[model samples]
Target: MTRILPLLLLILTALAAAQTVEQEQQPIPAEPEIAEASAEEVLDIPPGDISPLAGVDLTAPGDITVMDHPDDSGDRLIVSFSPGSEAEYADLFAAYIIYRRPAGGSDEEWTNVGVMPVGEGTQFVDGYDPDFPVNIGESYEYRVSALYLDETEVMGEPVIAQEVASGQWFHQGKVRVLVACLIFLGLIFYFFSRARMGATMYLRPIAGIEAIDEAIGRATEMGKPILYVPGLSDISDVATIASLTILGRVARKVAEYQTSLIVPNRDPIVYTVAEEAVKQAYLEAGRPDSYDPNSVFFLTQSQFAFVAGVNGIMMREKPATNFYLGMFWAESLILAETGSLSGAIQIAGTDAVTQLPFFITTCDYTLIGEELYAASAYLSREPMQMGSIKGLDSCKAILMVFITAGALMSIMDLLAGTQTLSWLKNIVTTQIVD
Candidate 1:
């Protein structure tokens, strides 16, 4: 009986130890109370709204008015208010909030349109939201409220105004540009009318133009073709147009002298125009049978490739006269040098300032900047063109006189410390209207 008692006691003690181990191995229960405390600490809310500018008195802005922004689209509203008495109190108020409501709308329907910082100018331009644009030709009530740092605001008395946006056919600001354009056109027309009425206009002789006949005659006598490069640019270029004009005159002379004429072009459009121009010239010169469709041909558009092709032509054909008229760039020297090497008499004209020196160095004759623009008018000698040129010259002369007088007056004003010519200076320099 005693041995059985001892084994029973051992078995009980082992069971108790096993139970203690099991309890220690189990997960502890999560405390909901601790989680609640942590959340409260992280996101604690204030008990009530309080003003940062509490205890400070601020005066409200008065006489708030709204009007249409003059000379502008109707989307803009110009808001103005009487300067607040607390202008010196920078910290008393945070900003002025502009509020607006449609006419007859309730105070609750007023929307916060814009905000201006404290100490800002009394005027504000409210360019409304593009997505919800303000209705044009509709009345609206506006108010300005001074906002405090503590989320408190003092509203001003509201005012009602409406504006309709309309556009003018002519902008008032561009009046000066319009007047200048009209005067220039009027002068051109006046000169053209006089030219048609038998007025004789004289143009200074351009040596490059004078040598055209001699160049064509030399080509005729030498029995060699005359090469004409109308430039490397497209027909859209004014220089190219001038080149084509000169080409017409040169083609007529070529037809009259019965000399072979060759024109190599870089642009396809210019090639086409040159061909028609040459054909018309031949027809006008009573030598339509001499017009050859193959005379003007399109060369490669690549600058250097065109230069190479022209140089090859110059070498192979050894043309007696080479006319480089139009726009040229880096390849100007290449063409001029090749023509010179081929023993050809070259007459080059271009508005490209950089290429002028190259042509002048290698060619027999060269036309400078404005000379290219005047070439067509000078060559044609039509009454309208002559008269227009004369008008332009007269304008230039008047401008020169004004410039000289202004300079003299400026010097006198500086030396004498007087504003005697100040009005004249302002009249000359200032635009008619801004």
Candidate 2:
């Protein structure tokens, strides 16, 4: 077997050598020379017919229609044309260039407005050009030309629009937005009416709000003052307003429990509002004389300085219960840590997302996000407040359902390649300009 293998190898080596020799002996072919032609020869046009319109289709685009653009702010005109001569001379047609002039204007006034590459789209909007926007309520005439690739064009007859561009009273595209808004308003009214009739609208319990009474009671038992910080924001802030509303409720409870209350402020305006709210709460609780004018006082306008002052109060007074509510900033941790170290049962609430982590870690119960805003309504449970909260929640639930459905459809369309739910996706993503 070894001897036969050597014989086969020798035959294969001889065959490879012979093929290499034959390939080396063959001659390589030369590349053909290409002669450059003149412009006339390349274009297939006679030298004498060297005009700009040479050998180009002179048939104009037909069925030119011009009108005021719909659903716009009265500054646009739409011009469209049919492929009459375009179909016959489709090979030479490169683009459709449009021109416009004032109505009844002469040929000298024809201005080159825009150029559209053929087959892209058959429509042109005149006022889309920022440099030469059409004036509203002005009449204009349009002319379209079929441009050929040979730097030549055939101009079409002019067409005048019957109606001048004008703004409409309502935008047609925002109908969906209008309908959604109307539905929300109707929900608000329905819930409002039901609430007025003493209907029991259920709301999920908030941990921070439920713990308020417990905290107040603990402070009363320990005979320690309750510290309430209405945040460090000004009076105009929504969080500050919500804090004030909550302050009224908290102060009334404090008044009823006959416990000492301390509210330190950074803004003088907030201090004024807080004082009034506390006094009114005392009046409401039938302990008007128990409301101390010095309880809700302005400490300082500086940020860190106010924190230092509040921390001092926490250390000295050793308040049994601490309430940190409103729009807190960088000072949130400083205040909450101080209260925690003082061994106070702390409850914090704020819409400030960045400060939530510190409060959650330090306080006993923390009202998260919208809970701070909903605190007043939850505590008061007034008919109007309950109704509005219920209506808002219902709208949110509906939106969540829509979002979930859209997400599912999007996933299905992506995986299965059906795209059957594209209409729903478009509706979900549509921008309504009102």
- Local distance difference test, candidate 1: 0.83
- My TM-score estimates for the predictions, one after another, are 0.61, 0.60
Summarize candidate 1's per-residue lDDT along 328-383 as a digit string, tens digits: 99999999999999999999999999999999999999988878878788888888
lDDT of 2: 0.89
Model 1 CA deviation exceeding 4 Å by range: 1-168, 171-174, 419-434
- Candidate 2 stretches with Cα past 4 Å from truth are 1-180, 427-434
Among all windows of ten consecutive residues in candidate 1, which has the lowest summed lDDT? 36-45
The lDDT for every candidate, in the order shown, is 0.83, 0.89
Best by lDDT: 2
Q: What is the lDDT of residue 73 in candidate 2?
A: 87
Q: Give the per-residue lDDT of model 2 (tens digit) for 1-434.
A: 86999799999999999989888555767878888665556467777677445554468876788888888889898888875466676665678989989999999999999999978788888888897788899988888888776656778889887778888888788888888799899998999999999999888999899999999999999999999999999999999999999999999999999999999999999999999999999999999989888898999999999999999999999999999999999999999999999999999999999999999999999999889988999999898899988888888888888888888998898899887767777777767665
